[model samples]
Target: MNAPFPPAADVGVPVEQPMLVEDADAVAWDQSTDLLVVGLGGAGLAAALEGIERGLSVIAVDRYACGGSTAANGGVFYAGGGTTIQREAGEDDSPEAMLDYLRIEAGKVVSDETLRRFVEQSPETVDWILRHGGKLAASVWKEKCSYPPLDRFLYHPDNSLVASYRARAKPAARGHRAFGRDGKKAWGLGKFITEPMTQSALRLGLVFHRYSEARQLVVDRDGRVVGARILSTPEGSPEARRFAKYIARANMLLAALPPSIPLASITIALGNHYLRKASEIEAKARFSRLIRAREGVVLSAGGFIMNPAMVRRYAPAYATGMPNGTLGDQGSGILLGMSAGGATALMDKVSAWRFINPPKAWAQAIAVDRAGERFVDETVYGATMGEHIVDYRGGVAWLIYDKSLREAAFRQARDPKLVPFQRDVTLLNLLFNARKAPTLDALARRIGVDAEGLVRTVATYNAAARGEAQDPFGKEAVDMHPIERGPFYAMDISIDSRFLPLPVITFGGLRVAEESGQVLDRAGKPIAGLYAAGRTAVGLASQTYVSGLSFADCFFSGRRAARHAARANV
Candidate 1:
């Protein structure tokens, strides 16, 4: 019988047709398993491992290598609520306190009950990760930083330390960084988290298909997802295997270079060349296979930040920012779920990070819009700052700093405790892009802001710093420094800056049942035998993003989906 759906193509565009193939029985299945997982990222690895532990046979597939965007991340897992590491580090915390803080951060994105459940299970979740060979240091990093240095493994990655959040609930460092094997590399720490779990899953009979893309959902007449149609490079083809090996080798070579290395751009270009060659080979050798998922199908394929068309459609404001995710995060999983009648929520929500810290002095400076009006607390988390800029300030803003703050930031850059990546980027922005003038009026004119407005704003800020008035943005006294010294500077922190790129990630996806990880339709009904985890689902970070929330949600939702799917009748 002819397949109902069109043949999968490598068009480099978002899948538009939902790609639903009904009448699963008519199609010839190449293989069968208890659960079929699409996209072997953090969530897929977790789901596969959990399924195998529950004695269910599982098969997983990914568009690239086994690691997706997760492996490219900082490897921070946000877990608190009296976790072993938190207690070991001499921090006092509880589930109620966590929920109270998250209630503000998470907002009404999830129900009170669902948020409570996540908070209550936080400690156990850390324990589970530790059991899987994931290692985290018990030492707490007590400093204001966008991300901790390579040697430090624990820090606060959210607004928990802000005055308002601390007033609501006690603050504690919850970002549990995975122990990285490569000390010099600032990123790819997520490998430490995924590699161990992936190894465990592989040892327990989880079959993972690399360079395979799931293009369509196979559903029964009852509207139940039964399997998936995957386009994969021929496993036995020598040429395809050789190209795959080349891609892996290139990635390893790129990972060895430090972020501060001058030859980094050339190496990155060469790596892209190898990836393109491998993609060409994979495309030519591609063949379709139908994998019957007897129990259920879990979509852990990650978010669509890398998909330009989807970004244009859902979040046009963030199109100028640097897309932050691997090639596999092209919204294929969300598209597959939609094809199975899954409804998506929070499609316009994107996390564009403009981290102005690591040299905490920079954040103490006042951030002004094009009109020279102060908009937000300069010391808030990067996501909050980025949101205010993109959503409210017309994607344009500048950080105004005094000579003392600039000098202090330069001194902090010299500190050995700073991450090399952060240090290099900070120096580049401060040295090259910052516009300097003898006075605030001259600085405002140089940066194309209202001169009078800029002068007035700085005067108000100075009054507050002098203890004569209250800060309009509620910035704490310690962080409020008067910009009175001459030679004021304005650094372009806009979303579209080429030198200082704002890394963006999508925070919206298929809406799922809170209790079970089942994908829900428009009418709020679960799409049977279909589930989603990680960025593919509207989970904890769908509303607002912190550094480690998505990774934590991957573990929570992936395990939830697998445990529930394992009980399904096969």
Candidate 2:
């Protein structure tokens, strides 16, 4: 079939991919290297750099730019198994503990071999990042937080939920943050990762082509992914606009990204800030440039968080919340893996919203459903609340607080004990959903809940707070406080956060082999010359989440795939 738009050749690019071209007699490869990488996010960067460190020729490309979703994130890399950082911070964590903890999160899909590799190779992966421009500190945090609260505390806090898991490993700090410069400046965690990784790729002499889109995977008669079709065009062009949809419908047509035009712009930064302007690093394309992968192709292009169709199909409940991914996370990577007979797992799994922890003071507040009756132990981590609300309350719940609790919430918002929080959103929630009433009945009427039920719930809670009766929900006394004082308030801290959506990322995608990071076929076989990493495949957070686990998996899976791919043809 002829392309609707006739394409032309992009200049100054050589053909480099590790597979045999079907039409080698007639078609000329735009660029050729031992390894051709698509997507320059953390996974892609890690993959490219891993190949380079092994002295293999490498070329990498991204649809938008080098930095994908990671650039916009608070880069948290989860690690443990007695790493130097953990040791320095005076925390004892064994590999078995990390495996135990992760097994619960990843569930049954990931193989035991993969879990072992993931736990065993984690420290080496950290070392690789450190050597190649990344930075992390060795300090155990003292407080319990969803994400890093005060630049310390890398491991998961000993949450009561984790304690209940069948694996039953004692909680330890494992999330590693990159503060960039001296490792003390707490700013862009993504930059700490993207900046260093990008520069390392450039320094290692890997060819980088930005603004080049991989439209489809080139398959030979043998039904294996050989290379990608490269297409270079304007961002909002008719073809580019329809690319994602077109790719999904006809997955094969989407894998290949042809060549592109020259001299647009190449922006580089040596550190946290922009270093200086330099020459343009361009990838010229004439027609859809067909560059064969001599070894293999990796899909680390992120998840489908931004794709409403995928969200609605997999998890309908999350269709209307704030998506925590970039414009490029349209599931092209997931689809690409699928198009090549790759079986996917956990597509239905998503962290629709993560409440984490709002404030220590708010722990004493009572959370109620539409009927105005307390259901959850409000003392649990905020991040853990979303699932319960979705399963039981249909995604909407209210946090009812007394004046003391409300005032403390405000204070904690201003000056958090563990981490600086978003005071604006907190205020917005209080200002909008919160109700101030002289009595529990009036507050219930104002908040649209059962008046009698609200009054009864409060009286029971107050009695429990006063230690007159055994607490019905097992809430510790430290988390108990009476709502006897009038002028009560309520804010809808539902899964959607009524005021603001709790930021969340999808944690499931294509299931790849743990040992090789190879994308597996539906029948549980490795497709030769094909692999996946990061959110593109099911890793670290196979289902549930632990702050930095996904990011750390990005680096580990990328490095793992590259380590195997670099040796695939040799």
Candidate 3:
């Protein structure tokens, strides 16, 4: 091992002081493996699978169970570079073209070389998932939607279709959602990917410890990370047995009841009770075990959006947004790496999504700030609009529309093609929450915006709709409906709006080697024997996010870390 380097300064106060580094020589190891993977989420599963493929003995630990936030996701895997699905859909896309768009979206968060490598590997990444039993439909959905409808499995989930990005590169649908079985409900489509990958890893002799959390990194005298201290509930323990039952019931309810059903709230609340009980039992029964990793310790435990303290400390602006990850997404992996001298980056970046489409007609509505000034192209990606509202508009905005536009949106919400959740939420927002008034000034007053400012903004927008001037925000003419009707409506699309909750995910964590996914210190040098992947490490979406980009990066970065660790000399 190399000589010990001085530990880097802590990246603010963590949710709690990370267990940091423990002297390897002072610990008694209960188990050992060539690679120790923390948090069996998408990234950890990928690393474990990859490590097993490379003939390395791997052991994985998860706080709850396998899946993590990935299992709760919409199952979209952002892939381009002429993937088989793209070709099957008759879409022309290449690594160069993909890079052209991503360069702008990613904004130099990663080196050009790293970004190019990511794009180049994208097609193979899709293939790798398929090889591991993950499914992607060949059909493409060409629509301007926040997310594809249940029947559609492929779409563009980023800024690629927007005018600005279309000019930079030919737009193509890149979100490849994992195929669900017939009669399957919408939501949590990610189970198709995570479940199969987990089974594949298990079948390949990967040792997994559920109800276990990695608390600290174990480092050799030379400051090389070699293992971890895991707190785990033994499989046969009373708490573990009870947790299995609770979690099984919870999963059953989650699978059976989509959020759109009115009774779903009560059933889901019961499911949450089971989950909470499971967590309580797990916490009570945990006992620490020292596990040595001969080659490397991979931290893939996800991000910190669920950690209130971390959210408030880092991306405070998004503190009020609903967190979108599992309970395990509390920055344990990132903090574990930080304790081992890992440098963090983009800690302030968060993806606060306030999607306004699905009832795609809603995109025609002009969004205004508190002062009633139009701020963004209504048809832009939801995250872009959300950023404008939260970062620039004091976390408040309203979608202003005439009665005709509102009616159109309501009609579209009734389309059978819309997912049940989307349809229900849209109907709820429009039918119950939308404020109606006789005039623009009255509408502004009803929604608590500047009345005169709203009137002027609408006049300017209507002139553009009538072809008297260019659209100020470059919104397409097709999405420009004049708001001159006497009956006007304003729907709150703000970050804190009760009717339209914004789901947020943190996009920041330990800075790592772009090539190998090795945790890097403040000096930009890789820490020997330590690696990080997924949200625990800064990757493609650290700067700005798009749907499926995080999942794709999980595959790319996880495999990179696993392969590098497997080949490294201990």
What local lDDT score does residue 291 receive in model 1, on the 0 to 100 scale? Answer: 95
| Clash count, predicted structure 1 | 0
Choose the strongest candidate by lDDT: 1
Model 3 lDDT, residue 390, Cα: 86
lDDT of each: 0.84, 0.68, 0.83
The predicted structure with the larger TM-score, 1 or 3, is: 1
What's the TM-score of every candidate structure?
0.93, 0.80, 0.92
Whichever of 2 and 3 has more lDDT, that candidate is: 3
- Candidate 1's TM-score reads 0.93
The list of candidate 2 runs beyond 4 A from truth reads 1-27, 148-167, 181-188, 233-287, 373-375, 416-421, 450-475
Candidate 3 lDDT score at position 549: 92
Number of the predicted model whose TM-score against the real structure is largest: 1
Candidate 3 wrongly placed segments (more than 4 Å): 1-27, 182-184, 247-276
lDDT of 2 at 128: 74
